[model samples]
Target: MNVESIRLINFRNYNSLNINLNKRINIFIGKNAQGKTNLLESIYMCATGRSFRTNRDKEIINFNKNEAYIGAMINIDNYEKFIEIKMERDKNKRIRVNKTELKNYKELYSGLNVVIFSPEDLKLVKGGPQERRSFLDMGISQIKPVYKYNINRYSKILFQRNNLLKSNKSKSEIFSLLDIFDVQMAKIGTDIIIERAKFIEGLSDICKNIHNITTLNNEDLTLEYISNVQLLKNKTNMEKEYLNKLKMNFSKDLEIGTTEIGPHRDDIIMYINNRDVKTYGSQGQQRTVVLSIKLSEVELIKKERGVYPVLLLDDVFSELDEERRKYLTRSFNEMQTIITATDVIDLEELQNVERSIFYIEEGKLII
Candidate 1:
């Protein structure tokens, strides 16, 4: 699957822009703060219905405009698809495919799959557990729409349960709500934990190989899903354990006025030579880990989705050394990639291949 073209209006700095894309290795070259990353963000929004940089959708609209529009022409399995999204201030966004409005936005997840790698991804290793959980949830949601539904349900239950706690309602009221929420949370959370364990297992296989290649076989890299509840071994055991912990922590949660446990609190750990990379690994090692995980994500998506997802590299070439950059470029040669960089010099080697150059300047694309 690949994006054939993209159209943007009132999106961030891009007042209006449209450009065709090369099926392989399309490069967006411009200086810093010239809307290079914004271009990739628009593509990401088209694919995922959300922004990677900000949770507020209104932030994507132009300062002078109250709404933003993004549309894409996608080619998947020899079929062409048209996807368009309309964002309005103080209102929910609208999405359409092939002139038909989507009844449920989740339906948009069927064909379009995108994998984004950016400088910010390095934080996946060093950042808090929320970032890692988000990585797993977002990837899984795209592959399984049911996960999206369950997540939404789980979040809603968590919100209501927390609100009840905050109100300092009667003990009976709290117990009733907690009972309902726990049952649903365990049901959905168990599914998520199980799937994540499987994903991490698959990722380990690919990451081990990629890490060996990236590090020249000098480092042994491993990924483990760190969970307070051991869900993978026995589903019922973990669910019961999590439920008991939630009950045990009820008083503390009430004092803090927050939901303290479940999949939201789980995380994935990366190790290099049996040492935690987040705290002990050098910057370069962290980059290698990020690269390995992303490549693993690509393979995982392909294996599960049965087609390669579009690869979006946002100024990532500038983050790697020459040897590593070469390895990354060579590895993705067969996949459709849209890369943003400050200059074309780093990518001159691919000029002879099937590629196109778009010069972006202050929200404008020079064809």
Candidate 2:
């Protein structure tokens, strides 16, 4: 999949702008705060129906404008289609594909599958488990849109259950309600756990190879889902196991005012030669693991979707060492990539094929 062009109106720093893009690799070069990341965010929002940088859609709108608009021409399976998304103040965002409104926003998931790597992604290994979980969810959702529904539904159920646990009512008054929440949670949580396991399972081999090549074969990388469901093996029925676990933890959860066990409480463990990266690996090892995982995302998506997902690199390559940068650049040959950096990268070092570089200044894109 590739983005053919993108137009932005009142999006972040861009009041109104439009630009065509390169199918192979398009690089946005500018100093910080010059709207480098903003352009990439526009493409991402168009693809995912949400923002990776912020939760509030209004934050994406320019202060002088009441609404933000993003339009793009996407190329998939030898055909091109247009998609538009507009978010207005105090209103729900509107999305249209080929000018037809969709009742289901989830259609955007398959419309544009993207793998993004911002500088913050460097923290994937050293950061909290939440970051790792977010990485897993984004990659998985592209292939399985139902995974998106399950996660959203699971989150809502978790919030309601937590609220009940913290309510003023006596424990006896809400015990039955908690049971209902557990049933729903188990049903949806099982889907989430199963999907997550499948994703990691698909990603494991590619990630290992990436880590080995980047680290000169000195380290063997590994990934595992550290789920709360102790009997997570496929042999056991997940929903039933989940209900039993929740029941076993009811007293503790009631005391803590939160649901205790499920995907929300799960994590991913990364290892190098059987050594935990978070605790034993050095800074370089940790960053390498994250990079390998990000690149592996591109392959995993291609394997599942039969099309390479657009790659968004937010000043991440500039921070890498020369060897690492070259290695990552080599992968760009096979995919559509949008990258942001302060200085323009030399395409000669990575590609002899077509590439487009846009210089950003004061929110304007000049090719």
Candidate 3:
């Protein structure tokens, strides 16, 4: 899918802006804090109906304004689509597809895919377990929108169960209610774990090739899902295992006032040459691992959905060396890519390529 154009109003530093984006490589050149990342964030928000950088939608609104608006005309498989989102400080965000209002985020999230690579993604390899799990979950969600629904449902149920655990209910009352919560969690969390395991299997297969190329055939990357409960190969046994663990940890969960034996506590482990990258990999190795993972998402999405997801690079080029830059961009030939950089030198190799270049100064786009 390719974004044909985008319009922004009172979003971050942009007061009001509209610009047509190139189908193949749109580069935004600007200094730090000049709204480069904000531009990419807006596109991401339109595609996913949420922000990647901030949790609170109000934070995206302009300081002097009470609302923010973002709209985009996207081309998916040669068909055009219109997506719009409006956020207010005191109200729920409104989303519309092809000018029709949607009741929930799920209505707008399906079939709109995007993979983003930012400096922050370096955390995928070097950061905590949650970081890696988020990376895995999002990569899976882009292709299988249904996975996002299950994830949201699991999250909500988990919240309710945790709240119940924190309440002053008696042991018998808590146990009775916990039985219902555990049943629901086992079903949803099992789906999450199973889908995550399959996605990791696919991601590991693709990332191995990508990591090899990125490292000149010197590394073998591996990815695995690590859950608090043992993952039995049998589906029945898997759910039973999770349910058993939840029961085993119920008392501990009550003591801690949280639901702790499920997918929420799960993680994705990354390795290179049989060594845990999180603990043993150097800075360069970690970056390469992240790059491989991000690029592999593009291929995995294409294979699963039969289309390449749009790529968003937020000021990450400055961190990559020349060789890695070439390897990264080599796959950009046909995909829609939006890159943010501080200067032309940061994207010198692409300067001569057929592309669209825009300069941002104080939130305004100058072509």
Best by TM-score: 3
Instruction: Report the lDDT tens digits of candidate 3 across residue range 60-104.
Output: 999999999998999988888899999999999999988899998
Q: Give the worst 10-residue stretch by lDDT in candidate 2.
A: 102-111
lDDT of each: 0.85, 0.86, 0.87
Give residue 194's lDDT in candidate 3 (0 to 100).
86
After superposition, the stretches of candidate 3 with alpha carbons farther than 4 Å from their true spots are 345-352
The model with the greatest lDDT is 3
TM-score of each: 0.95, 0.95, 0.96
Candidate 2 local lDDT, 103-124, one digit each (tens): 7555565368888887788668
> Which lDDT value does model 3 have at 348?
56
lDDT of 1: 0.85
Pairs of residues at least 3 apart in sequence or in different chains that clash in candidate 1: none
Return the TM-score for candidate 1, rounded to 2 decimals.
0.95
